[model samples]
Target: MSSNKITLKKIAEIAGVHRSTVDKVIHNRPGVSDAVREKILRILKEKDYQPNFIGRALRNQENRKTIAVVSSRVNSEPYLHQGIQQAVQEVGVFGYDVEYYIFDIEQIDQQIEMLYTLAHQKINGIILQALYDARIPGVVSDLAECGIPVVLLNFDHPGCTDALCYIGQDSRKAGRTAAHLAKAFLHGSGRIAVINGYYEKILNIYDRCSGFTAYLAEIAPAVEIAEIVDSSENAHDLYHAAVDLLRRQQIDCIYATSSGTEGIGKAIGELGLQDRTHIICHDLYPEILRMLREGMVWATLSQDLEKQGYLAFQYLVYYLLKGIDPPSKKILIEVDIRLKENMPET
Candidate 1:
C-alpha cells in the first residue's frame, strides 16, 4: 500500500492534533469541532493523500467485478456514447470491467432476455440509462435478490427498491429553467412549440415535459404551448417538425426536450427565422453547440451527461463495497445557461 503510505499519526503531527483526535475526525465522530475537522482535512488535501484503491479492491470478493452499462442504440447521438465511455474508463482503474450493451429499442423483449443472460454471467453491477420499462422493479429485485447492485442513471424507477442510488439532473428543474428562458426571450407571450423525441415508453421525457408544462403554466400564463409533437428520434424528422411548427404558428419560441437541437437549428435558419424567434434546447450536443454559438438557440439546459454517467457508477461502487449510502440523494446536476458569446466549442 505504498500509495497510501501516510499514517494517521503522521497526518496528526502535521495537523497539530493527537493520533486519536485525528482518528475521531477521520471517522466523523462528534467529539472533533468543525474547525479542527477543517484543519485536518486541509492537511490531508495538501499532502495529496490517496487511499490504496487497488488494495481495497483485492480485499473485496467482488474485486475486478464486471459492470455493465446498458443503453438504447448509440444511433446518431455520439455524445451519449462518449459520456458513458468516459465514465467507465474513469472507473476502470478501480478494478471494474465496464462493458456497454446497446439494445434495440423496438425489441425490448430481447433486451430483457439479454440482461437475464448477463445476470447469470456474474455481473456485479449495472448502470442503466435511456429508456425505462415498467417491469424494471421485478428485474431490479431479481438482481438485488442475487446480490447485484443497480444504479439508475438519468431516469428514475419509482418503485424499484433495488436501485442503490440515482444520479442525474432534475428534469423538472430543467423544465422550469426552460420556461423562464422561453418567457424572457419571447418577451412575455408568444405561441411556443415543443418537440419531443420518439418514445414507446420512457421516464425522462415524461418528467421533463411535465416540468416544462407545469412551470410555463404557472409563470407565463398567456404563452400558448402547442400540441404534442413527436420526431421519430431522427434528425430529419426533427428538422421538418421545427419547420412545420414555425411556418404554421409564427412560433416566437421553440423548446426541444430531446437531442434534436442540431436539426432544429437547421430548420430555423432555412426559414430565416433564426433572428426572429428564440430557441432553447436540452443536451449541449454538437448541433446545439453551433446554434448556441450562432445565437439561434438562446440558452441550453445542460446536465453534464459525462458527469452523470461517471458519478452514477462511482456512487454504485461506493455503496457496493463500502457499505455506505451515496453522499447525495437525487443529485441534480446544476443548470447552466449558454448564450451566443459564452458557448464553449466542443
Candidate 2:
C-alpha cells in the first residue's frame, strides 16, 4: 500500500488490535506487548509507512502551543517567578501559551502527581524543576521515548538518559566557591557548619556539599566542619538545627548550601553570633539581600535564574519551530557571588 493511503487505523485492522494500541506502539507510548509492538513495527517498515509529524506539529501550532513550567512553590521563591516571567514574555511573542504549575518539593507524592499530569497533558514540551524521586527516571524516560521533550530547569536527573538537556548552574562549583569565601573570611582556621536540604534525595544539594567539603579540605587544612545539618528546606527546622549546633560546638562560620537561610540567620542573631560568625548562603532573594545589607549574611552565590528559564524556553521554541535540537545536552548558567558591595541592581 502507498504510504499516503496507509493510515494508522488500517494498520491496526491488519494487526487485529485496537487503533489506540497501534498509536501507542507507533509513538513509543506504554501498554503494548513487546511481541505485538515488534510485529506492528515490522509491518509498518515493510509497507513504508511514514508519519507526517511536521505537518501535524504545524496544525497543532495553529490551534495552540502549550508549554508547562513546573517548579517548587513560587509564592516563597521570587527567583522562580522571575524566571517564569521571562519565559512567559518570550514564548508569548511567538503565540505559544505557557502554564505554571507549582509543587511542594518536600511533598514527594505531589511532585509525582504533577509530573503525571504533565505527561498526560500532551504538551508541546516541558520546563521542569524536578524534585528527586525514585519513580522520576521512568516518567522522564517514558516522556522522551513518547516524543515529548523535557528541559530541566535548575535541577536534573543525571542518571536519566531521556532528559534532553539541562539549563542551570553547575551546583558543585557553587559549593566550591562558598568554601573559598569561608576560607578567606576565617583566615583558613575555623569551625564551619554546613546546612543543606534533603541531601539523600536532592542531587543539587548533595553536589554542593561535596564540592564545598572537597575544596575546604584542599585549601583550609586547619579548618574542620563542626556539623553537617540536613534541614529539609524548612527555615524553622534549620533555625532549630543551627541553635542546637551553636550550643554544642563553636561554629565560626556557616555555609548554607540550600534553602532556609532566614531561619539560620535568626538562630545566629538570637545567639549573638551574627557579629562574629560569617554566614554564606545561596540565592539573592529579597530576604537574602536584606540579610546582606543588614550584615547578617556575609556572602551569597547567585545563579542567573531568569536567564536559565529564558534559555529553556528558547530551546523548546527552536525544536518545535525549526526541528532543531539544542546545541549541547548540558548548558551551564553563570554563577555569581554576591556581596553587599556588588549586589544585583534592583
Question: Which stretches of model 2 miss by more than 4 angstroms?
Answer: 1-62, 74-78
Candidate 1 lDDT tens digits, 262-313: 7777888898887787678877677778778777788888888777776777
- What is candidate 2's TM-score against the reference? 0.78
Query: Per-residue lDDT for 84 in model 1?
Result: 59
**TM-score for each candidate, following the candidate numbering:** 0.78, 0.78
Which clashing pairs does model 2 show? Answer: none
Candidate 2: tens digits of C-alpha lDDT, residues 1-346 = 6788888898889899999987766554558887897687766766667635323323443576788877776222457557666656544534467787776666778876877777777588887777777777787787787677888878878766777788888999999999999999889898999988778867888999999999999999999998898876778888898899888888888998877888889998999888777689988777789899988788999887777877888887888778898998888976798999998777
Tell me the whole-model lDDT of each prediction, alpha carbons only.
0.73, 0.79
Give candidate 1's whole-model lDDT.
Answer: 0.73
